[model samples]
Target: MATTDTQPKRLPILTFCAGHMAVDWPHGAFWVLQPPIALAMGLSPSQMGLMVALTAVGATLSLLPAGMLSDHTRRRGPVFAGTFVWVVVGYGLASLAPDFWTLTLMLAIAGMGTSAWHPLATGTLTQTMAGQRARVLGIHAMGGTLAEVFAPLLTGVLLLYLDWREGLALAVIPAAVVGIIFFQARDRLTVETASAARLGDLKEMMQQWTSKTGLALVSMISIYNMAVMSVLAMATLYIVNDLGFSVFWGGVAFSAMILAGAVFQPIMGHLSDTMGRRKIFAISLFAAAPLGFAMPFIGSPWVAIGFLIVMIGAFYGVRSVVLASAVDFAGKREGTTLGLAFTLMDGVGALGAFLGGWAGDFDLAYAFALASGFAMISGTIALGSTLAFPKIQAEPAE
Candidate 1:
């Protein structure tokens, strides 16, 4: 279990939202640039898949430790701010990579920086803002979703004047500024922990996660992430490579997928608070399943673009809700639980990205279809595990 302040402090939702945006910006920017980078390097789909998978590997390496550190640390500001700087430095160097393998290594390093923020920040958010978990998590998610919505389009516009490397370099500027702000303001981000992170805590967390209910929850979220991550990695390629769109249009397409999430994340978060995480999650997944399955079959780019909007909109907030639910089960170990949840999500998601990339080699449409199937499977898992999820108490009518 983790510690908490006796007198709750005012939630720094906006500050953390900014942090979330800064953390996610590089990730979204790099993802959209993959098609152009691959073309420039004369890389195949499999190699791209490997790069995405390795990036996930980098994230997994840091996520758990960061989460545990958050649980034990008295002041989280330095870690939080430092992770932001880490992202800036990693991605900035990635921009200067001279070769494919070097580029992959740099990107993986950046991935580590990007992923480390989640446990420190999200764990704090969930623990401190426990009562309104869904709503706050939703708002928090909007920050990242906003970055996801904008990064691709911004990178695309930049690509008009600069090469992919320059675009990558340019994207880190805002994050660098944000990182400096976080570091300077580190004192305010303190969370007093009752106990230090220990071997027993780690053993308990591992055992709990490996338990029947824990494994079920983990499997459901992991499968859902597989669908979401694979699509995120493949959609831009589908637009640029298969749809005959320019890199700018690929940016447009990728940004469009996340646009609704920025608007709907908080709303869905509120609904999840009042309605229930499991129900809303299942609805979102079920709704997205068909849309994703049908995307590859759509011949017109315009229609496919529309489908992307609706499908992704339905998928919006699902991750936030999932995170909130996992925290609900954490008792006092919110940070450790988040670390485990995120690790499972990205680790399994790595496999999906790898396999999806291979499928893209044959046909991007096939990857999209496969992602749809994963969504369906995940939704079914959610629906079946009513007993596994914590029961929600709907908020009173306002």
Candidate 2:
């Protein structure tokens, strides 16, 4: 009989990471590409804004179910399978969509795919890496940041040569390929181990939520999401409509912000490991709050671009630290804890998005200012909570 090598495989991890990056690419691409779609479909600003809102709403609604499935099954196959089908079919349908209503439905389908990836991928990484959870998660999140950088630039180039429909349709090819790769890797993803008892996962997650550390981290996530989403959803519009920049250049500005995020996330993750969470966490949040408030004060387009880079860098850098803190507080129930924390925070962030959109309707500067205000409140909460929790040493890598 042939003996199978006992050595662990890295291909599965690579496949999972690449699949995530592929799907996220379109998240940023959609924002840059939406204007062209709106023009083609004759959608009003309110209608377009509602479409963006639905994307978040759909993702938010799906998180709980997705988390439960990943935890109970301890299998990522179904999650990967579901995400792949939806991305391909959803975007394919979007390409052929005849009107706004159909496009909305298609986007909601795509949102389900996007929603499924997070809990499952994060859970798998948490289990696989064991003691090295923070570093691994940081690496995984870097994929998202990198996608944010590439998506708009790629989509902008595609839009120049093709219409929006065809450009969207082209996304289907990569989705199909990744789906196949995920299926092949499914057997390799068998759960290596779990940190906590399955029966107590929910109770444990709930208990953590009440802890000062958990509450602080959750609050930090909420504020970070609000600030990030407000800028992400509106930055393209602000550049084109308010700053008198071309769509191409607007995409360039957005890419610059994500580029900064990509560089800083890993640095913050390393800091979280070496420097201690409380100090780094407090400094990042406090620094980001003021930068967020200063966003509207920039006078020229170039200055505005610089402000975006600084603001997004600080915002995303702190977010990386906050997520690492969640792993620290969650103890053995990292997956379930992360799911619950993300669900609560994202749910609140969804409300923030609606508020931002409404505020933007009145005035763009006013909307951003509202986001800044929320960030300040969240930073204050995080500062206090950090003092209450006990410091824990970083776990060793498996």
Which prediction has the highest lDDT against the true structure?
Answer: 1
Write model 1 residue lDDT over 1-398, tens digit each, in one string.
Answer: 13333324554679888888888898889878998899899988778888888888777889989999989997887888889888889999999998889998898888888888888888787777778877777888888888888999999999898899998988887788888888888777877687987999999877877877777778888998888777777888888888899989889888888987677778777887777777788888887788778876798988887887777777765788788778765666778888888898898888888888998899887777888898888888877777554552232221
lDDT of 2: 0.68
Instruction: Estimate every model's Cα lDDT from 0 to 1.
Output: 0.81, 0.68
lDDT of 1: 0.81
Q: Tens digit of lDDT per residue, candidate 2, span 1-398?
A: 22232112443666667887776766767877776886788754455666776667766666656665665664556667778787787777877878888787777777677767777777767765755565677778777777778777777778778887877777566668878877777655655443434556677677767776656677777776776666666667667677887677777888888888878877777776776765666676567666557766867778777877777777676655666666676665555656665665556666666666666676555556666777677767666765565554342221
Q: Which consecutive 10 residues in model 2 have the weakest lDDT in total? A: 1-10
